[model samples]
Target chain A: MNMVVCVKQVIDPEAPPASFKINQSDNTVVPPSGIPPVLSPFDENAIEAALQIKDAQGGKITAVSLGINLLRDVVKKPLSMGADDLILLEDEAFVNGDSLSTAYALAMAIKKIGEYDIIFCGRQAADWDAGQVGSGIAEILGLPCVTLAKKIDITNGKARIERVTADGYEVIEVSLPALITVSNEFGEPRYPTIKGIMAAKRKQPIVWKAADIESESSKLGATGRRTKLLKLFQPVREGECEIIEGESPEEAAVNLALKLREAKVI
Target chain B: MADYKGVMVYGESTDGKLAAITTELLGCGRKLADDLGQELYAVILGSDINGLAQEAIAFGADKVFTVDDPLLKDYQSDSYTPVMEKVVKEVMPEIILLGQTSLGRDLAPRLAFRLDTAVSMDCIDLSIDPESKLMLQTRSVYGGNAQATFTSESSPQIATVRAKTMSSMERDDSRKGEIITIEAGLDPSAIRTKVLEKVIEEVEGIKIEDAEVVVAGGRGIGSEEGFKQLGELAKILNGAVGASRPPCDNGWISDSSQVGLTGKIVSPNVYIAVAVSGASQHMSGCSGSKNIIAINRDPDANIFKASHYGVVGDWKKILPAFTSKVKELLDK
Candidate 1:
């Protein structure tokens, strides 16, 4: 079996909110100082999903990413975690591409890579939270897709998955050569060991440019983007909090309930 | 300029009844359609779901499209995608809206990709640009640290709105609308994915997402027993219990009760967050609540920043007092 996992490098979502700054002029987020970029939490889950598959069925995993000025250190996290190889699609034009174009570029790269039985992606990117690219890639490749899979297992040449739903969960089975978007429910990702990190340093990723992937120049980046960012801003929260005054915890609780009743919220 | 016209909404149903999120989509869709001076249309796909078409009209849709098929009764993307693609080609609606539920999240991207368009997922707000006639979609990003507005350059602007952000419109049975039954030509054999089983967990009380008031706990609650106290307070207020991701991940609570970006997004009348340090990820789920009251031992807990009222204390003692006080008020 062969698997392809897609990963992304993003600003640390767990960083203190005050540290994040936005560039209102370009409608983009500015990475905070001191905090280095890290692999998206969901993408780590995707890699873990791939590793689990490899552990059971014995397969080679290739982790892929598309970005400009590609953070080599950050993109290599998957390789450190256990991916056999890494493929980076880096170009100046790849900057700020929308979900459609990004998926297009990825599909093209996958086609160039040739043989693969399954593809894995994070349920959604932490930055935009679009959650479209995985299915978008499946569409471009003309393959079946299952989103938000919490568990996956290969059985009788078919992939059985447990998908998360609003109320509970559902079990679905699909043929191979399919794509799945792994959700957080999959489980915590494994931490890279010292030996794995040492081995990763020797495994340099193969980098490809826009022209190398045989993608049409017209459909590469901003030119192929179907959505335009209109504006970006922080939502304003008004009104000062009225801290309930009390000498003790019990007193505060009583005062708080009284205030809620007066406000007609209960 | 593209000659695109009406606004279309995907009316979703669960267990033979129209989902509340579908009604919410219609409410927002009605405003967008009216602002664009076009028709408000709804597309329903399920076996024996003709009744939903009428409900769609009462909620605000001017025309409802029905594709009743047994294959579509269960949402297989392969079966529904071709049918929706055919409807989009025939209707040529300028804007397509859906609720950002599990179904919509699975289908919208596939449809958008097939149509060569773009989609904005989990939008909290939508408005039409009078000058360009483009749908401006506002969605949370960076774990709810910021909101970004986007417009599709393509013909059909596709978007999925988060539930509870928009209220469902008042239903008017007197209103009438057109119900068109279209042939989906669905071939069940073509679908590669097969559903093995669906287990709907039996919940004991009101769902946390639908509750008018939510009493939530976090890691500070200490243990599963701590959540029991929170549940008692919720019961007294006629509300529901919720939790942050930590408690859920720790197995103190079920994932269904977890309120965060990865969990359920809820907007209740009042959200009482106890023992929860307000992470942006957790706040994003319930920030839309009308009022927030936080109780934490640490006075500088991040949750205080987003709260309308704050109490510095331990939840163990405070919750009991709060529950009694709430019980007293209700007795009056």
Candidate 2:
């Protein structure tokens, strides 16, 4: 089996909520200083989905990422987690692209890779939280697609997936050469081992620019955006939490309960 | 602008009635259509959903579109995407709305790409720009840390509205509207996937989304045993127990009890977050609560930023005392 998983490097979602900052001049996040970027959390689940398939069927997993100034350490974490190869569509032309343009670039790169049984992507990126690129790529590739999958099992050249639903879950079956978006409910992704890290350090990622993927210049980045972002701003929070007080911790708990009742909030 | 005229909403049904989210969309669509001096159209698809068209009309839709087919009984993306594509092209609506739901999340993007258009997903606010006569879609990004307003240049601009963010109009049976039936015309061969089974693991209590009061735990809750205390508090308060991602992911609580961006978005009258640090993603789910009460050991925990009331102490010590005190007061 040959599998392709799309991963993205993003600001650490686990960073302190207070540290999240955005630049108003441009609609972009101001990356927190001490925290280095990590693989988007759900994308790690996607890679784990591919890794599970590879482990069961003895196949190869190729991790694909699209961005500008791609961080080798961040993108390479997929390889360190047992993916066979890493492909980066790293170029200036790919910067600030929305779902439409980003998916188009990824579809082109996947076509260049030529052969694959399955394609995996996170349900959504942490930064933009659009949750559209996976579907867009499947549409552009004309491939059968499933989104928000919690579990996937391959049998008789078909993939049986447990798709997450509002109420519960639905088991769906689709043929091979399909695209699946992995959800966080799939379980934690495996951490990189010392041996896997050593192997990944020895392997250099294959980087592809716009020309390498043969993408349309006009359709590459911000120019290719279909939706114009009129404004990006943080919503102010009214921090007026009246901390319940007492001499002791237990007394504070009693005061809290009393306060809720007094305020008619309970 | 001449080619596209009305505003369209893709509606869904639950247990044979119009879904709450669909009604909300119709309500929202009604305002936008009235603003544009156009009509509000609603579309429903299912095996035996003809009855819902009239319900949609009563809930603020001026016209209703119905597509009845066994193939569409389950929302397979392949079938629904094309079906919607055909309907949107034929209807020629200037703006289209869908619920930010399992069906909409799976369908809107694919449908938009197929129609060579653009979509704004999970929008909290949507309106028409008076100057340009274009739809302004505002959505929470960065997991509710920031909001972005977007406008699509393409005709039939699409957006999926978040659940409960928009209100449903009061039903008026006196309202009159037209009902149009459309042909599914789906090819079984074209459907590449099958839904083999559906498993509904409902929590045995008031659902967090519907609860008046919610007691939520987080990583600080530590273990399954810890969640049991939260359950006790929820039971005493006549509410439901919820969890942030860590507790759910850690298997201390069921995944259904998770309240976050990827989980359920809930806005109860009172949200008591126990030991939750209020990450932006988790905050996106419960920030709409009328009052937020947070109890955490760390004084600087982010939960306090958005909380209305707070207690700085260990949940293990505070929760039991708080629960007892509430029980005592309610007993009187």
Candidate 3:
């Protein structure tokens, strides 16, 4: 079995509030100081999902990423974690692409990669939280797609998965050649070992440009994007917080409950 | 130019009852439809759900489209997508709104992809641009650090809004609307995915999302034993127990009890965050809570900034005292 996993580099979602800066002109986030870019946390889970399948099924896993600059550290992180190969869809035109255009470029890359049994993607990117690219890719490739799978196992040309639902979870089974978006409930991703890191240094990722992927320039970037970002701003918080004061923890707790009761919230 | 007419909202139902988010979507859809001078239509797919269709109309839908089939009872992307695609083709609504629940998150993107459109997920607010007549969808990004407004250039603007963010319209049984029964034409053989079984994690007490007050614990809770104190406090207050990501990830609590960007976004009237450091991810989920009371030993904890009330102390000491105080108050 062969598999492909889509990974993206995003500003760490857990970064401190003060670290982020907004560029009003473009309505995009500026990379924070002292905080380096990391692979989207869920994408790391995607790599782990693929690695687990390869470990059990005896197959090669290819990690695909689309972005500009394509940091060396971020690009190799998947390979270091046990992906067999890496494909970088790098071009100036790919920078401002929205979910649909990004999916279009990735579907093209997968078609070029040719042989594959399944594809894996993070449930959603921590940055934009769009959660659309995986299904979009599946639609473009004309394959069935499942989102938010907490556990997945492939057997007899079919993949059985436990997908997350609102109240609980449901067991599902889909045939091979499908796309699955993994959720964090799948479990913690394994950290790369020293030997794996050394091996990653020797395996260089194949770089592809817009022309190499044969995508139209007009349909590959900001021009091709179906959605337009109007503005990026923080919502102004309303109401002043009144602190309940007391000399001791017990007294404070008493005063707090009284305040909630006074407010009719209790 | 495309002549897209009505505003369509996908009405989601569970156990023969309409989901709260469906009414919330209709509330927003009613406003957008009124602004666009288009009718508001609610599309429900399920078996024996005519009652839900009437409820949709009572909650501000001008028209309801019902597709009742046994295959539609369970929500599978492969089974529902074709039927939805067929409905959209026939109805041709200009704006499509859905709740960002599990089903919506799974279905909206697939439908958008099939229709060759784009989707804005987990939006907090929706409005219509008077000039362009396009739907402006606003959603929090980067774990609630900022909100971005998105507008799609495609024919049908698709969006999924977070639950509890928008108000649901009051149900008025006196209100009358049209109900159109549509043929699903679903082929059971075409369904690729099969449902093996559903495992519902049973949680006692009011669900964390629907609770009026939520008592949430974080890494500062120390151990599973600490959660017991939280449960005690919640029980005294007639509320529910929630947790930050660490406790849930560490197996100290169930994943369903998690309150954060990745877990459940809640907006209880009062939220008591115990031993929680208030990471932005966790804060985003509960920021909508009316009153937040943070109890942590560290005075500089970020949670304090987002809290309405702060009690700087050890949770081990604070929780027991808090529970006793609440119990005493309730006893009176």
- For every model in order, the fraction of real contacts preserved is 0.82, 0.90, 0.76
Number of the top-ranking candidate, with lDDT as the measure: 2
**DockQ of all models, two decimals each:** 0.75, 0.88, 0.72
Candidate 3, which segments miss by more than 4 Å at Cα?
A243-251, A258-265
How does each model score on TM-score?
A: 0.96, 0.99, 0.97
Candidate 3 achieves a global lDDT of 0.88
Question: Which 10 consecutive residues of model 1 chain B have the lowest summed lDDT?
Answer: B199-208
Q: Which has the greatest TM-score? A: 2
All models: lDDT?
0.90, 0.92, 0.88
Worst 10 residues of 2 chain B by lDDT: B201-210
Rate residue B42 of model 1 by lDDT. 97
What lDDT does candidate 2 reach at residue A214?
72
List, residue by residue over B51-132, the lDDT tens digit for candidate 3. Answer: 9989998999999998999998788989888999999999999999998988899899999988888899999999999998
> What tens digits encode model 2's per-residue C-alpha lDDT throughout A1-266?
99999999988988887888888898778989999988899999999999999888899899999887678899999999999999998888887878999999999999999999999999999988999999998999999999999999999999999999887899999998999999999999999999999999999999998999877888878888899999999998986999998888889999999999999987
Indicate the DockQ of the complex predicted as candidate 1.
0.75
Q: TM-score (0 to 1) for chain A, all models?
A: 0.96, 0.97, 0.96
